[model samples]
Target: KYQRAATCLTKDREALLAFYDFPADHWDHLRTSNPIESVFVTVRHRTVRTKGALSQKTARLMVYKLVQAAAKGWRRLKGANQLPMVTEGVKFTDGVIDAKNRAA
Candidate 1:
């Protein structure tokens, strides 16, 4: 009965598990929905309420201001310090860098 669902997950196992290659502190950030999506949600709500009345330039400015406002309340990444290591190609296994597979 669940064969299709099981097969789909099996097929994408590697891709789904790819997040394990990041530092443990960053795992939470990677697992959550895109941060930008939250900011856009506010813009979407406002624009929908206003219908099509906004001019193109006004819409652009509103979106920019909305995003700017949203950013003020945004939380910092959990492991901002680890970003440098990740960008440097350091490999992690189950969150922490595996001594055996350290980046050359």
Candidate 2:
């Protein structure tokens, strides 16, 4: 089991490093799936506990509203204003903008 785990980690090291691209304030959010799981929990519970069969449209609408409501309370991502710089291929190292990439 340990051998398999070590091999997997070695193979995915680059993917793991991708998380470092985000600012520190976003690390906890990136490292876990809790936020996504929480949103799905609402949909899953409603669908599973539902008594009668829902029409396709009804189920779709239910999920849509649930997700939209969930989105309402979401805070903006940290360093959101710098997102444009990121899109333009600016580089960050250890969550800080790289010295050469820093704007004057």
Candidate 3:
């Protein structure tokens, strides 16, 4: 959303420092729930491309197999420890290491 919704802040240092002194949660980056949902949508599209009806039990097994493969792929992505995509666009004067530092 940051790439698309570029918000510009007009506050000076005094006001900006006062605002960020409050505590904020940092859980958004650690969650994988949305990424998994995106993977599911892609897989569903692929599965539906060449499909036919099946017995209820067979359908369940097919879904399990497909999801097992997906889970394995998700595990392989655990090494991606880069910073989350920046939102609100942090501006740097100099020596800012991360977004939090610049925002402060």
Q: Clash pairs of candidate 3? A: none
The best candidate in terms of TM-score: 1
Off by over 4 Å in 3: 1-32, 76-104
Error of 2 at 72 (Å): 3.7
Please list all clashing residue pairs in model 1, or write none if there are none.
Answer: none
Residue-level lDDT of model 3, residues 1-103, one tens digit each, is 6643333334355555543332222233244476679678756865697485377787677777777777765543432332242243443222223566544
Weakest 10 consecutive residues of candidate 3 by summed lDDT: 20-29
Where model 1 places Cα greater than 4 Å from the true spot, the runs are 1-10, 100-104
List model 1 lDDT by residue over 1-104, tens digit each.
99999999999999999988888898778777868689879889988888855588988888889899889998898888888888988888999888865644
Order candidates by TM-score, high to low: 1, 2, 3
Model with the higher lDDT, candidate 1 or 2 = 1
* Per-residue error (Å), model 2, residue 83: 2.3
TM-score between model 3 and native? 0.38
Estimate, for each residue in 65-98, the C-alpha lDDT of model 2 and write its tens digit: 9888888877667766877876887777888888
After aligning candidate 1 to the native by TM-score, how far in Å is the CA of 23 from where it should be? 1.0
